[model samples]
Target: MKKLLLLVGGSAGLGEALYSHYKNLDYDIVEFSRSGQQPEHVFLDMSRKETAIDTIDLQFAQLAKQPWQEIVLIINAAQIGPIGELAMSEPKQWWQNIEVNLTLPISIMGRFQTHFQAVEAPKNIAFVSSGAATSVIEGWSLYSATKAGVEHFIRVVAQEQSSKSNPITPVILNPGIMDTQMQATIRSSSEAQFSNVDWFKQAHETGQLASPATVAGNIAAVLSGKLEAGQVYDVSG
Candidate 1:
């Protein structure tokens, strides 16, 4: 049976690249994103919890039989909004960022773990993380806070899944500064909005930013290869 590669946020950026790469490798790719282009693709609007629920419900049905040797999951979905200042940002927007980055991953991972518990094949799950998890950028209060939370959350999941007879492996990854649309947005930010705007702009201008495809390759390698506990593997290195 063909293995399944469930790609969250597969419609764009690093997600798109990973989907293409894994598809070529013959994994049964299921894309979950905001784009409702195909019936097989699960539409996701990260700002809302309902979309995540729907996607989980549908996948539960498909993988109910999870007859393949293993299922690979890559979570490349995140929100970088509520920028500028903590007090200046709207409560709804800031909360939504936390929901997307923190709550959604736990929900998805729990469902998959419960469903695949009996399966003997190891299920490797990876989160697309960033350096912001440990950074204190001036305008990224919401984004930084959420990333930090999930990084620790993954550690908790790792401990829970570490027991013998459990095939679930969780990996919290820091994919580094990639030349994605998010980087472009940072590059365009005003100095007041982002203190390091010139730094990012220079990275782009000097071709220092990593390619999305390259980072995706590093992610795919870790998720499909090994489970290094408590380590946040940075793809840049």
Candidate 2:
């Protein structure tokens, strides 16, 4: 049975790299993105509840019939908006951030759990959490809270699954800092608030920031059983 690697949010940085790498592998590669160009890919907007659930159900139906040995979900869809104190920030923007970061991952995992529980295969879920989950930085309350919530959710799920008859390994990962579009968006939005924007740009210009390919390789390694399950791996090199 060919292993199935289902990559969510494949149009962006880390997700894009994961798709590119796994598509060339012997295993079957399926991807979902808002604007995916690859074959066997579907367009999915994770922010919309109905759309997200419908897309996931369609994908699950297809996968359940296949001779797949494993399922890997990479939740990499994120929005980086203007930074400001929570009191000064727009309430809608904060809600949007929570929807994308926290709610989407929870929904994805719920779908995965429902689908994989019946399958007699080893199922693993890898959540692409952020360093902001633990570190406190000004003007990042929304991002930080959402990420931290995701990590805690994954941890609790892992604990519950450990005692189940059929178990799924859920890993909460912090991929560290990378030179991705999210970072670029953050730097571009309200540069005055993010005083280190210029420094980050300089790092990217000088090739100091890690490439998406590098981060993707680390993620693939984890999925390949090279890394321990249920432990957070920081992909900082």
| Best candidate according to TM-score | 1
Residue-by-residue lDDT tens digits, candidate 2, 1-237:
778887878886888888888876765877877898888788888667678888888788778777677767777777655476767677887777778888887988898888777777778888888887898877777888888998888888888888878788888777777878887776675655665667767777887778888888888877777534567887654
- In angstroms, the error of model 1 at 134 is 1.3
Candidate 1 regions off by >4 Å?
36-39
What is the C-alpha local distance difference test score of each model?
A: 0.79, 0.78
Measured against the true structure, the TM-scores of the candidates, in listed sequence, are 0.93, 0.92
lDDT of 1 by residue, 1-237 (tens): 778887888887788888878877888888888873534588777678877766786776668576886788788898887678877768888889888887887777777777776777667788877788897788998788787887788888788777848557778788888888888888778887888899899888998988888988887777776677656887763
Weakest ten-residue segment in model 2 by summed lDDT: 187-196
- Candidate 2 lDDT (Cα, 0 to 1): 0.78
TM-score, candidate number 2? 0.92
